[model samples]
Target chain A: MTLHAIDLSVSRGGVAVLEGLNFSLSPGTALVLRGPNGSGKTTLLRTVAGLQPPLAGRVEGGGEEIAYAAHADGLKAMLSVSENLSFWASVFGTGDIVAALRAFDLEALSDRLAGTLSAGQKRRLGLARLMVTGRAIWVLDEPTVSLDAASVELFAAAVRTHLGQGGSALIATHIDLGLDTELLDVTPFRAVWRASDPDEAFL
Target chain B: MIALLTRDLRLGVRAGGGFGLGLAFFLIVTVLVPFSIGPESALLARIAPGILWLGALLACLLSLDRILALDWEDGSLDLLATAPLPMEGIVSIKALAHWITTGLPLVLVAPALGVLLNLPGPGYLWVTASLLLGTPALSVIGTFGAALTVGIKRGGLLLSLLVLPLYVPTLIFGAEVARRGAAGLEVVTPLTMLAGITFGVIALLPFASAAVLRINLR
Candidate 1:
């Protein structure tokens, strides 16, 4: 199976941000979405993950098979690192958080409160969630926002392993993830602004 | 769904949790009413059921924002939307968690608060029963309000505004049952109506809450 978006248009706050976007992600491949800030990278990923309705066109496949990780880490500050991971595992109907913890090198901090972790550690915990999702497609929004150099490599290795296992990923981030993935720069599809645009009135 | 319920319950009881806040508010409101209205046993007995119902309603409202706002703020709501669980089930679970943490406590403590208000002996059982039957609707309806305002910054006020009016029917029937019991009048009609409202809200409002949540997330 594959994830395909056909002539997709995405908007934020009702204003069209990106229009006429198209891409296909097959199993065992990664698609890196490259765009500058405020370019609708987050919006596009949310649409593809089925978290929001696309402004136009449609995304085929990637339904329940997609696991979305947004810029916010989604961890409860009072919960331990392992508790956070295991909670997601249960929600996603998976039980193998051990692998996820080991994948992110979080075994040592598994019992630490998530709030006490460093920014990079929290990011790693957030990224570790993708492993326990038990879904084939990973939709990550700025997944490496606060990761260190070594942590970046660790994330890249996880992506590689996911791809190697016949899974796909759609990552929206400016930082280089150091993977041999196809690059789709979204700048060309940026929607033009119009003062009289109906969508602008509400904003 | 159970996983969600347990996690939310654990979070509610943890430090910085909102678990006891609603109960404390209920207690304060009940305690203050005596001082404000004066400690005349006759007047206190006359208004005890209404005052207790009002306190419990406000207590339930105080914690409504916690149902979805925490998850929405932390981005867990988005991941939850994408999870295999249906949005309706997720919303229902959240409402259930809200009841356990907020509504159920109010139910258990209503009789004690009833006593503080100088409620008559017969009013105690009916007030507790009415709260047990009615607070589920409050939690469910409050979940709908929480969903509607999930995307707004500092939405607690708006959530109360949206939820309070919807609470009228439950409050009317709930207070009616207790008031009638306190006055030693026939209570069957309001009690049945209160139970019906609770069941109906439990059955139907999750769909509305789930729809609102999806729109907010969108």
Candidate 2:
């Protein structure tokens, strides 16, 4: 099975921000979405993950196979590191969080409150969520923000492991994640503003 | 659903998690009413049922924002939306959690607060019973308001405005039950209506709350 975005058009705040996008992601491959700021990278990822409906066309094959991680970590500050991981694991119908904790090298901080973790540690905890999702396709928006060099390497390794297991990923970030993946520049798909249209003028 | 409920309960009980805030507010409001209304025992007893109902309603409102706002702010709501659990189930679980954290406490504590208000002896049981039956509806309806305003910054005020009017039917029936019971009048009608409203809202409002949440997230 494969994740396919057929001529997808995504909108934010009732305004089209990207249009005419087409891509397919087969198992065991990764697609790195490269784009400048405000180029709808987050929107595209959200659409692919089925969190928001695309304005036009369709994203086929996501169904229950996609796990999305936005800029917001989704980690509860009141919960401990392991509690956070286990909570998501249980939500996603999985029970084991050991692999996720070990994957992110978070075993040591398992009992620490998430609120007390450093920025990089929190990001790592966020990235560790992908492992417990039990989904084949990961849709990540700026997954590496605030990660230190070593944590970045850990994230890349995690992505490699995910791809090695016949899974696919669609990552939207500017920095190189140090993985052998196909690059799709989202800038070309950016929606253009036309002054002739009154609706466009308001934007 | 159980996982979500437990997680929410755990968070609510934790430090800085707002578990006791609603109960505290309820206590404060109940305590303050005696001073404002003076030391007239007859008057306090007469208005005690209404005052207690108002206090409980306000207490429920005080904690409504916590039902979904914490999850939304921490991005857990997005993850919840993407999970296998249906939105309706998620909203229901949140309402349950809200009842556990806010409504249940109000019900348990209303009897003691009724003493301070100089409520008649019969009014105590009715107040507790009315709150126990009606507060679930308050929590459920409040979940709808929380879902509607989950995306807005500092939405507590708007939530109260949107939810208070919806709370009117519950308040009317709840106060009626308590008031009738206090006066030793026939109380079955309003009690039955209050139970009906609670059961009805419990059954139906989750869909509306889930729809509102989906729209807000979109």
Residue-level error in angstroms, candidate 2, position A16: 1.0
Scored by DockQ, the top model is 1
lDDT of 1 at A138: 94
> How high is the DockQ of candidate 2?
0.81
Candidate 1: pairs in clash = none
Q: Score chain B of candidate 1 by TM-score.
A: 0.98
TM-score of each: 0.97, 0.97
Chain B only, TM-score of each candidate: 0.98, 0.98
Error of 1 at B69 (Å): 1.1
Q: Please list the Cα RMSD from the true structure of every candidate, rounded to 1 decimal place.
A: 1.5, 1.7
Strongest candidate by lDDT: 1
Off by over 4 Å in 2: A195-203
Model 2 TM-score (2 dp): 0.97
